[model samples]
Target: MSNLVRSELLKIRTTSTWWWLAIGAFLSIAMAFPLNAWLFNTAVEGNAEDVGLTGDAASAPAQAANLYTSGQYLGLMFVMLIGILMVTNEFFHQTATTTFLATPRRTAVIVSKLIAASLLGFVFWLVTTVIDLGAGAIFLTLNDHGTLLGEWEVQRALLLNLMAYAIWTVLGVGIGTLITNQLGAVITASVLYLIGTQVVSVLFFMLSSWLDSLAVLKWQVLWPAVASQVMITPGENEMLPAWWVGVLVLIGYALVSGIIGVLLTRRRDIS
Candidate 1:
């Protein structure tokens, strides 16, 4: 275990990409807090979300939670790219073979990378949460929407958001394993999250009620909004899964990817 962890840390330390990814996550959350507060101050207060949804419609805490979290991750795009690179570089850079020859426990390598990435994700998530929340609070005070802070919902959101990002790092590792090429994995993930998925989701929102079987969280809408909406609202129905539902769906993909990556690393001629 120590050997595998040492190998993973060495690999990450030798690269500049990891630092940049962490920085990107930091900046995204930092900017998002102030921006969200301004948007809510201007837009939500101006009939933005329709009655019963904003201003006096719902709990101020809920509205504040939604505003701070909605776009809290503009940097996550780059963060995912860096994560893909970390896993796939072994295949591209001709190191996986040598490492396996020395260690022989192939699965250990993947697990080590998964653990490292998860910790890295957690650190960034904590920093991002602090700054983002602080900024929201300061801006809210300036704008005269101050509160004395609420109860467990904020704590729940912070914890869940960290778990979500950590899971995403695992998912990115899986993508790197399956593709075995950093650029391909990053681009494919980006397309799914940034473009293709969102487009389909918007269309679903327009047609959900009419479709009879369609719900806002159908495949189209569900994952696309998962990153933004997971902690922003409480579960609506007892039948509905918790906020981590979509994230759990994502973990299945990560497990598959990681297992296949171990197999490929063991068998493939990693030149």
Candidate 2:
């Protein structure tokens, strides 16, 4: 298992795609700095009418938390693409044959890929978090907005954002595995994570409007992103499940996708 995991890491490290993905994710984080700085400055100058600065939005902690979380979220798509490519690229280049030949037990190979993808996700999360936080703090300081690095609320938000990124990456891996075609997998993940959630939310809204009794379904977990929003943003949505329940829902999505992918791969003929 250890050897298999090492081989997967080596495969990733040897590829130009990994570096590009990492660099892209970092660049996304870097780009968020200016946007956040502008937003912070605008709010500071009492131009919070356009932005979502409602009651207490002028508070330092609130501003800091928003800056950090928003910046980290910006990089989420890139990391997920990395995860999708990690698996789909194998099939794209016809390397899965060699990989499976080296490890006859397809389950072991799948597990190794999961482990490698998880590690890659964590590394991506770390890079994005550090860059976003450092840049955000600098911008805030320069604008005289003050820093909330020491605030417990800001600290907790930072941790949750990192965890959310990591979880999303793993989910991407499962999605990539299930959809072996590179383009297909990427499209599916994008639609499911990005568009699918909004569609579901809208549908639920319509259903509840037509039938108030159906409102109960609104609280039921449907999408991983929705569950994650519930977990990270407390008290904002009364219809969302509890934080722990949201965590479980996310885990369920990742695990079920992995299991299905493994089963399909075990029966698939590489040649």
Candidate 3:
């Protein structure tokens, strides 16, 4: 298993895909942090009612969480693409046949890909987190909102952010497994992640309004993107489920994707 994982990592390191995705993730974080910090500062000063923050929402922990998790929206998408590329690249390069022939046990190969993809995801999280911490600390101090590292809410947000990175990558692997066509998988995943979430949210909002019940809004957490956002939220939200619910939702998606991917790969005709 170790050797298989190492081989998978080597494959990733040898390619340009990983670095391109990493660069995208880094840029997303860099561009997002300052904008988020500015908006947060604006809200903190009581001038931005449209920012949707009030009382507890404007607390140090909440601001810190938001700052620390900045760029998650696009970062996760890039990470997921990396996962999709991991499997798709195999098929794209005509290496699937060789890979399976060498390994024989397809499950081990898939698991190794999952492990490697996950490590790559962690690297993304680590890089983004370091930037967040440094920028967040300075921003917080400038705004008189202590670094708040001692706060559990801040800590939980960071931890959950890391989990989000890992799980999304695994989910990507599952996506790649299902869609072997590299271009199709990448386009589908990118569109669904970047646009589908907004479309789904709008539909849900319309449904809730028609039904005259805000309860319908809670179901938004079922979507992976929303679930990711929900899990890292620093405090209670009336419109969303508990933070753990989001974690569970994402985990369920990853598990289902993995199981289906494994089952399909076992019988797939690589040739």
| lDDT agreement with native, every candidate | 0.64, 0.75, 0.90
Clashing pairs in 1: none
Give the number of the best model, judged by TM-score.
3
- Residue 144's lDDT within candidate 1 is 84
Which digits, one per residue and each the tens of the lDDT, describe model 3 over residues 62-98?
7778888888889999999999999999999999988
Ranking of all predicted structures according to TM-score, beginning with the best and ending with the worst: 3, 2, 1
Give the range where candidate 3 is weakest over 10 consecutive residues by summed lDDT. Answer: 47-56
All candidates in order of lDDT, best leading: 3, 2, 1
lDDT of 2 by residue, 1-271 (tens): 9999899889888889878867777676667666766776777778787786655555567567767765455466677787788789889999988888888999898888888878877887787777777777777787676677888767877777666777777777788888899999988877776788778888878777777765465464656777776555533334545566667787788789889878998998876
> Which 10 residues in a row give candidate 1 its minimum summed lDDT?
50-59
Provide TM-scores for the models.
0.81, 0.85, 0.97
Query: Which ranges of candidate 3 are over 4 A from the true structure?
Result: none
Q: Residue 19 deviation, candidate 3, in Å?
A: 0.7
Best by lDDT: 3
Better candidate by lDDT, 1 or 2: 2
Backbone N/Cα/C clashes per model: 0, 0, 0
Query: Where does model 2 exceed 4 Å of error?
Result: 41-50, 53-59, 212-221, 236-242
